[model samples]
Target: MNTYDPAALECLAAIVEEGGFERAAQRLNVTQSAVSQRLRALEAQVGSVLIVRSRPLRPTHAGQLLLKHTKQMRLLRADLERDLQDLAPRSPGGARDEERISIAINADSIATWALDALTPLARRNLPIEIITDDQDFTQEWLRSGQVLGCVTTLKQPLRGCRVLPLGAMEYVAVASPEFAKSQLPDGLSAHNFRDVTFICFNRKDDMQAEFVARRFGLKRVSLASIFVPSSEGQVRAVAAGWGVTVVPELMAAPLIAKGLLVDLAPGFKLQIQLYWHSWNLESEVLNALAEALTHAAGQSLVA
Candidate 1:
């Protein structure tokens, strides 16, 4: 088997994560020329282009494979650190930025149960990076090897990965009391839903349209959208009477009870089943994360 240099692999990962040679050099504490030289050596070793020189740096297929290997190495290091902590107070060098584990989670989950799930690990000073995207799209991070795991809507496990059911998060449509009184007095119905603006997470979010179509039995539905790009921001916008939004019932509950917002569709709730997908690796850190998330999710999400 041909062995590749670990430093060269790390150089590739740093370039992609930091977005440029200069930044990668700064992060790695090396000269820009050294970073470029390392990358050139790696590409020559692999006999393929490892990075696409785009507005934002992106990894090629071979680059992604190497990156994943690098991450697995990082996980192994974390395990070694934990095991050695009892014998030695601290490692000679602390965790590096390159060792930070990354995961993709939906913003709704992040705004609700997910942060609580991650609190224990964070408190222990586990180096982690949370990347938020729409739930339906989070699996792409796993597929691209950019993240070792993700909380996503995809039920099926990706190749070389394992999946665990995290239960369903219920979604409900909500608006401010004044907005409800003024724009949807009788609440959302087939007859009146089209009359108001719908606040969406982003252009990629179709939850608003999907809920309307499912509730009203429409073959196709279109909504007047105002993009918020944030889970909490969408609720804040709705409460300020900008428009209505569909949000996690967990987040909507306290506001609804406080009269800050009103449920627009009483009987219409959307249940989004969530799943946790992780690489099939025997890593203690990954297992601990899964345990924390699944335990917290069990308490909050609907079965």
Candidate 2:
């Protein structure tokens, strides 16, 4: 059997996480030379270039595989520690333990309902690190081992991962009552869309454009739009009559009830089915979190 050094592997992971050699050394409480030497030795043993030497260090493909192993090892170790603690006698002055769970979620879910699902875990003192991305793209974070789990639009699980279905989140095109009256007097047709402005989450967000194309059967219609990256800010901008935008039904419901906004197309809606994807590990904490999230989704999302 070949021997591998855990400390050296840890150094590589630290470098990637910290985004620099100096920061990795500081985190490991070692000298910069020691960190360099260890990485060199590990690279030699592995016979591959593990990292790209850049201003902010990045891991090569080989390095990412090793980093995935490192992260898995850490989770297993934490599970073991928790089991051992359960067997030990309780003491008032015992060290307070907190497990770290890294997950990726879409901005819309986080802004609307996912945070409530995680509240129980937070109350139990579990430290969760959330990486936010578009739901369609969050799977990339899981594939790269940047996060152990993610809330995504992917129904198919990644290799060695399990998936749980979270119901669909509905969205509707909405505008302020005043804007709807003025800008959409002709009532939303292919020809009139050019006159209305839109609010988008970002340039990468194509949901609004997709909705328009699907509804009007007009491909590649470039309507005027302003980008507001924040979810709440997007709603606020639309409410202030900045522009019409697509918003989650849950978010728009309250405002619509109070006459703050009007549904531009009452019959047309977009529903995105979401799923929870996680590594296939027998982790109690992860299982509990998944259950909580699924239950929360059941309550908040459309079946």
Candidate 3:
């Protein structure tokens, strides 16, 4: 077995995190030449080019694998340190240190009930770095080791990861009362879809389009559309009568109840099943976070 150098692994991780050798050197408090040399030595030992050396440097397949290992080791070491600290005697007035856990989550969930689920962790002074993407796509972040866990639409567990269903988030097609009266007077149909504008979170978001297609039976229907990337902004834009949009039921319910927005299709709804995916590590923090999130989801989401 080939022995891996810890320093080299640290250098590789820093390079990827900082996006270049010079920046990595700055972060590692080393010279640029030193960073380059360590990477060369690591690649030689592993017999693979770990980094692509591109603008905004990227990790190769081998580099990503090693990076994943490095991150997992860091988590385990942090857990061990916390355990040891619990057993050690604390000095008077010693300040507690905060630890960070990275997670990937969908914008809709973040805008809805996910943040509430994480309130317990925040209260414990544990910092979380959230990477936001569509639930359908967050799985890629988990595969690349960018996050320790994710709330995604994918039910299949990744290798070294465990998954649990968190229930489905229901969405309703809604628009401002005025817009609904003017554009969807006859309700959502292929006839009026051409005149009605649609609001999309981003180009990658196809939920609104999918809903239109499913309800109207037009697979390739084209309508005037506006891109509003933020989850709250999407609701605000629709509420301002910019266009009709689909919003999570948890968010839309209040607006609909307040008469600020009207549900275009009352009986029809879009349901997205959410799953929590996390590294299968025996760490108290990870398990606690999962439990808190699961409990919150049970209360907030539909069965």
For candidate 2, write residues 14-49 as lDDT tens digits.
788778889888988999999999999999999999
Question: What is the descending TM-score order?
Answer: 1, 3, 2
lDDT of 2 at 110: 91
Cα miss at 208, model 2 (Å)? 1.1
How many steric overlaps are in each model, in order? 0, 0, 0
Model 3 stretches with alpha carbons more than 4 Å out: 21-34, 84-99, 217-223
* lDDT for residue 100 in candidate 1, whole number 0-100: 84
Candidate 3's residue-wise lDDT over 72-149, tens digit each? 766675566456755773343332211236789999999988899998766544556788998889988889886789
Checking candidate 1 for backbone clashes, the offending pairs are none
Q: Scored by CA lDDT, what does every candidate get? A: 0.91, 0.83, 0.83
Greater-lDDT candidate between 1 and 3: 1
How would you encode candidate 1's per-residue C-alpha lDDT over 171-201 as one tens digit per residue?
Answer: 9999999999999999999988889999999
> By how many angstroms RMSD does model 2 differ from the true structure?
3.3
Model 1: residue 111 alpha-carbon error in angstroms: 0.5
**Which ten residues in a row are the worst by lDDT in model 1?**
86-95
Q: Give candidate 1's TM-score.
A: 0.96
